[model samples]
Target chain A: MTTVGEVSRPSRVADPDEAISAEELQLAARNHGIPLEALRYDVTPAGLHYLLIHYDIPDVDPATHTLTVDGAVARPLALDLAALRERPRVTHRVTLECAGNGRALLHPRPVSQPWLVEAVGNAEWTGTPLAPLLREAGVAPEAVDVVFTGADHGVERGVEQDYQRALPVADALREEVLLAYEMNGAPLLPQHGAPLRLIVPGWYGMAHVKWLRGITVSTEEFTGYQNAVAYRLRRDADDPGEPVTRIEPRALVRPPGFPDFMSRTRMLRPGPCTVDGRAWSGHAPVMSVEVTTDGGANWAPAMLDAAGGDWSWRRWRFEWSPEPGRYVLGARATDASGRTQPVEQPWNRGGFANNLVQRVEVVVVAE
Target chain B: MTTVGEVSRPSRVADPDEAISAEELQLAARNHGIPLEALRYDVTPAGLHYLLIHYDIPDVDPATHTLTVDGAVARPLALDLAALRERPRVTHRVTLECAGNGRALLHPRPVSQPWLVEAVGNAEWTGTPLAPLLREAGVAPEAVDVVFTGADHGVERGVEQDYQRALPVADALREEVLLAYEMNGAPLLPQHGAPLRLIVPGWYGMAHVKWLRGITVSTEEFTGYQNAVAYRLRRDADDPGEPVTRIEPRALVRPPGFPDFMSRTRMLRPGPCTVDGRAWSGHAPVMSVEVTTDGGANWAPAMLDAAGGDWSWRRWRFEWSPEPGRYVLGARATDASGRTQPVEQPWNRGGFANNLVQRVEVVVVAE
Candidate 1:
């Protein structure tokens, strides 16, 4: 990507394929993970979005790539990118979540990619509604599950097969679900799963398969490793645990006025200050977000902008005049389904969806 | 520099000349500012040293590079690299300090470059003693200050000139002050002033002029722009301010064992854990270092490793068994001269030499 010439301001992600050497690629990975402080930016620039690949992000060429829909269908269809783009296209903003966003906060931290609150991002996706595509295929009555297969294949948890996950036929036919082709008005970057990917609005990233290859409507439930074993929030060995699906309601605060996060301690001028962030929930739309500057002693309502649509993250802002001293900045989000973030989320086996309140320590210097 | 192939392991710095375009150069400048977190590595490698160039680093050819000593010297001498290397050489480990190490922390934030605490580094410098060179040239009794000039030129504070600083003749004559030609056992890198640099141990980096061109023994007290207008701690407009010198006593703790810093918060296990860090003082050798995990309520002495030398930094370690919870880690250092780090350094107009206690916030997960 051609970045503007500033030679000082940093961007989030780089093309892994073009990176000079293995060391340069390594440096790119570290440098591109945009710190959540960049939340102040309205549309998290393309590559700067948080990355979480289940196994591999197999490269796909748009010219040769095609999507095959079969099994429990009256007509099997193999549609190429040109044909897919020709269908009625819809653009919608949605927030994609990793499901394991707060895994690092879990005590006795469970198995999974260790992520803080940064494993989430809001972006605009342009695609054809999956319900229309599934309707055109004419699903049979016996079909119970729709399994999505990605071209990216690897042995995860000893299962040597293409990465697969199944959605109950009912959720698969939801009008909000998308066969996404574009992100934030631009074609997807490779690290973000280029060519074709799913955009399961209101669901964690695992449900949104990248490098889409095949769609199989199954007669029986498909228990893939991702759905049945990995991504499960297990309480104990006996409990098979509930599969992680919908994104948990959560919010993260950035010190307002957009300061450079190069420093460990957030410094502020002791006067009129603002705290702002983004809040998202998959179960329902975010209703409200609250912020506390004095360690939860008193919370104040924050203004939230939801113009991006129901499934998209809302920008939250709060203004406060603070005195010169140290303060613990805290924020909690509540969703339309009445799910408010907890003070301390219970630790689970795989550390999925542990969205405790987000807190940041800030120091106010004399003005 | 050939870095060993560990694709995921992060390094502090990289060559800027090879970066793609000026944008990549800016990115390299930002990404290469080695995070303060890299201090976990003992003896920061040559290229990984923290860099803050005041002006463009002019390239100097080793074949033609020479140090010209004139002014009040009884006999002026211009010595080339080979001639200087013929003299007795010594390699010594010393910590270099930037006068603006904590400029960002200053209230009203007075400087253009808002440097945090990562502006310091320790390295092994190989060179002949400056005192002996001056002694051979026969220093005149009238010499008051030894002025050092570097080839780097720029317009700083609206003045266009090559960088320059001065040291009192007494301090310049100290045996430890080195006319360094090599760094960390290798010839100095271009960014590091290549042909030669002055190593004024126990003093801030302003005293260590890189790309050394000329050294003049001034009969009158030197009043250069760098010495008179910058690197001074001023409280108000009328205050001429005291020139900042000598690295202050300070210590930074790295988690006991090497732990990945990918987590937003430093992750540690419950039960016995060790934490270690580096400490140094300019006025004298670091006599003691203490750590406080309870936010300054209590202090515990830490074992220090200082066998390297008086001018070198001491590695300090502390063992603690912390209960599962959140903690604010703090460290302070004391020097043999009885100088101790303060809890809060008073604010200065120019934002120079802010050395307060260093604190790190960490999380302890249950095992």
Candidate 2:
């Protein structure tokens, strides 16, 4: 058993034959992904949204909790929930995907949250733009990074600390960045980070810190555990690895028909069926979505909905007519930058940013 | 691989040493349990409330949805959402627990949802009482059971059908029975059976059918799959087990102190601490809650809060000052009917109604 202090060692990939540890199961039970069927909704409901709380949700009293801006800022300001809400509010339909969305699918799984492909949600987040707040506080000219600290506290890989992450000054100053307090027009739910949380549109969920409490303008580069040690793509334990950022181009098909209780295998009648799904990319606008009914052997373009906001996912649909048989349905997306989802993602030590094409097995029975 | 028509065989208990199957992991990823920390709230928030969707969340259009009452009822009628909301309204805080909550904890686990102890939530359900509606429909005196059919349709063990369950006439007519359309003071989210659902206050969650659309008063007992085949306590494949019903007494402690990310083991400085949790029972009001620091060897009574409503859980707390060391904390509850939570629940084939005592591991370090 790995004790508290002993967990400081390098990340351990589970043995291929080993069963999921009780510890991983514990995390999976608490954090959940949006059910693939939920893709039917234009905006994911608050409760059905994918949630990844690194630690315990800090108890924040809305009346007393305040956001403190300090460090290299010219004017260190403390804003309460009411003050933040009084600012000009904007709502954006943004898609957020966890960096470890496909961690459990890796061959030697990185032993963390054990997520499959379901860890993604698109929601309308309402809040004041973060750039204006930073401008009001007057960021120092030499400030290289902005560090966001959340009230959630715990030990990650043996380091005892509050959850913290740093964003490059340019990214922090982006107009789309927000101090969101509402999700889907409702005050943020506790599990979704009530009081306040950061929303970095177009970035993976890790960049959007939850239960945010502090913003520190740092002259020096901020090297926090979350940004420095975790959420990195590495080949092995010894590699320093590149920092993971942005959502990779990926597409998922809402399982077309009803599912079997235990196996979740899709069972549908043989006929013409219109399959639809949502696709998104953080690097650039999703340029195209492709569907394949016979795995990846053949592909056809799917009609895309008129582009949604720059950060939200776009819906796409493909028409298919098939005879009664077993078929593996696959969907893949390509961004304007020409980045496309891979058929097989390379294995990484931390299991970060594995965006392989999704495949759903469907059995069309003869009616 | 189990295909569409091939799953009609007897239920299979997974090998004790086998890893969780892809199917079980798929289910776990889609459904979620309330984080134990959520126990802090009096009423579980809508999103944080545990959810278990047996199949797909039926895409319901509230504007067009209607509830039909027929069968042994003299006046067959269809009530639209507006008509149902025109009736007298009542709100109740009810605690619902899944029958398979501790299934994965069993030695030869049932190959289904694979839930731990977290599949329980207390929430406020608002709607009109059911007895009046039945009376308005003029149910015949010969009606022995009322059958509920939900919009959610799927195959369970090769049986393809809309989700359906039956309740005895007396239980269905209980004053507290409701046809709930709202949860936590808001319209039901799509995943939670938008538009309408049934709330059998004191019964297991299986009885509170989601996406409810029809009610049929039956002359004879309805031997539907859900009532006679599923959700039963069986000794083996051939054993005709007793039907699982109301919840058993159980207590859950909110994990204290901070947690290690991967292991979720508690790390707190040695000092005086208040260990608090919630306890409830459907058979009777919870009479006593006991706390233990050294596993289950020694036990002490905890203070209970003033009783909430009849179907809701009551809060309890225990104070302790312990020295620095590792200790396993345990909590158990006993109801007014003298039914206490078992230390180790007897294993059943379907893994229903297994309410074992909850044990949390904690490491109290010197400050």
Candidate 3:
């Protein structure tokens, strides 16, 4: 491990940019132009960071950094990163998407950080469940919200301060939600919220605070800038619809691409190809996924990766022999809660919670 | 140009996938560790495509394919691509944004082809103004809208049909709107609506029809699937907000990187950096751009490229020198209409018309 005073730390990454060339990415998704399929958990086990944050990747030394629990708690506790890690550890593969994952797909597209679907990823998070920590701190009965603050500070909207978010006491005490320090079986990257971060499975990425510093038990409702001003399902300039929470049912079919057409990539070659995708829902388990090549002309079931439990996206695959022609491919997902990916997603000004069907276009040529 | 068949198309590209290695993309944005600066459009003239469309890039022979003007026009006319091109050519640099450009950034993030800001592109289009053609066609006084039909066909939102869009007769007659035949001074690529496409300056990309095939002068309002069911600024499932028209005040900082992180790229070093970006407004000419390196604490005006007329994004730049630290950089734009990009944007069910100020975080380290 490189120390803070090292003359020159070997590049955190051999190549500072940790991205595969579009050509390589397309080659990886060469299954009948199924581009989303290129995002396989086996190949890319770490989850994608849907949001592009340009903050300092703080080099937090486990020896110095500490997580504090205060406010209405019976015992205000402060624990360093290592002491926190020594607690019971848990691991689960979870898929996390920024609430704004498909923000650019909105019609009057918002002017915020334009995010496409890449603002998401699935990963193995190993850390202590949040509930154990909360219980150990003896939450006061009157505490209604659990507020979290991160080490990264910035000026957002108009506020310049550390990133902060709040969860209801109930959610803060869930067994699945963790204070994760390890991602994909390794320590978290600085960009991924190193040393300590909160991983609220089933919630959007915003709820997962990186470089976590403190947890506050609030008797009154928490209204931090991130909680009150941002992340809302906005409607008009003045009307803030509601606070955004939970992931909606969604699926992605990765595909190969031709140069100049990353969005509309085609496999080029015709004939038989296996198509597959990943599906998930924060509200419930992804029950099933159906595929259609000719719009909705036909539907076919796909083989699925056995349940890795809730919060993680499920992998599904199908095979087809498509002839030389233009086709619109689609994937729809139904969750265990009886919620299926809608033909049309509900719209909001803040561009929140759009769980509509994903349609991809492809032109297959003769092999 | 190669014909329908030849020894080979030399492979439109060496590989179908055109993404750069993620590492390289990340490194390119390492200036002072500011990632968003990676979005550098000055280096790329033809902007980016943010839409997800699937259809064979038809190799239309201009000799065979024709543009027909019919419906509520006095003299119905049909003209081949060549005849259309011969009609007084005009060229202008304009920016095109998919109506759903920020859709992925919405709150509950839609599942439809997730589009972030990459759905926008600025290009020099050469074509004849639609107004002259309408005047020649003697548009009936009763005509309310001019409907445009593209030769391309695809299935969207479960509808299998050709791509189509319409403009109010008044809007259609605007000289800035054109029956474009070339982009960036060259015949559009097949995917970019080869042969002929409509270039509706200052309007969302949906207003520009690719593969121009038909222009119908309609006395009544036009309600095609693209207009009625899809592309509408929807509210709830039932509340179709309104037809999305006109480009709002928006600015983009072009950066380099992998396909996914197109909007955010950093400059890794902690030295002097010249930052530049493009701004546009369908509402009016871009008046000015303000940049801030110390968050919103201070704002400095960025030098802008003189107006090249309307519809195209204005170019702006700012130079700065910094020490080692983390910073949140921001860019906000103002238009001739006296409208400035908002700190937060109104949300629509379709995630439409979001023009929030953009903030980019960066980590500046010692050179």
Best by lDDT: 2
Q: What TM-score would chain B receive for each of the candidates shown?
A: 0.88, 0.97, 0.82
TM-scores of the candidates in the order shown: 0.50, 0.98, 0.50
* DockQ, cand. 3: 0.03
* lDDT at position B156, candidate 1: 50
Q: Candidate 1, B153: how far from true, in Å?
A: 24
Q: What is the lDDT of residue B170 in candidate 1?
A: 97
Model 3: per-residue Cα lDDT over B330-350, one tens digit each: 778898899787665566766
Candidate 3 lDDT over A1-367, as tens digits, reads: 1111221111111123333433222211110111243365432332222334523334467678989999999999999877887899999778877776655455655544334455567778899998988898999999999999988654343344577899999999888989899887778865577789999989988899988999999999998877887788866667755898899888777653231122233434566677877888999988899998887778888888887767778888888777776677778888989887666556676566777666666666543
Clashing residue pairs in candidate 2 (N, C-alpha, C atoms within 3 angstroms): none
Output the worst ten-in-a-row residue range by lDDT, candidate 2 chain A: A1-10
Best by DockQ: 2
Per-residue lDDT for A125-168 in model 2, tens only?
A: 99999999999999999999999999999998878889999999
lDDT of 1 by residue, A155-258 (tens): 34334457788999999999888888998787775556678888889999889988888999999988887788776877765578888889888888864421
Residue range B246-291, candidate 1, lDDT tens digits: 8888887763321221222344557887788888888988889999
- Residue A11, candidate 1: Cα error in Å is 33
**Candidate 1, RMSD to the unseen true structure:** 19.1
| Residue ranges of candidate 3 with Cα displaced over 4 Å | A1-37, A46-51, A54-56, A256-264, A296-298, B1-367
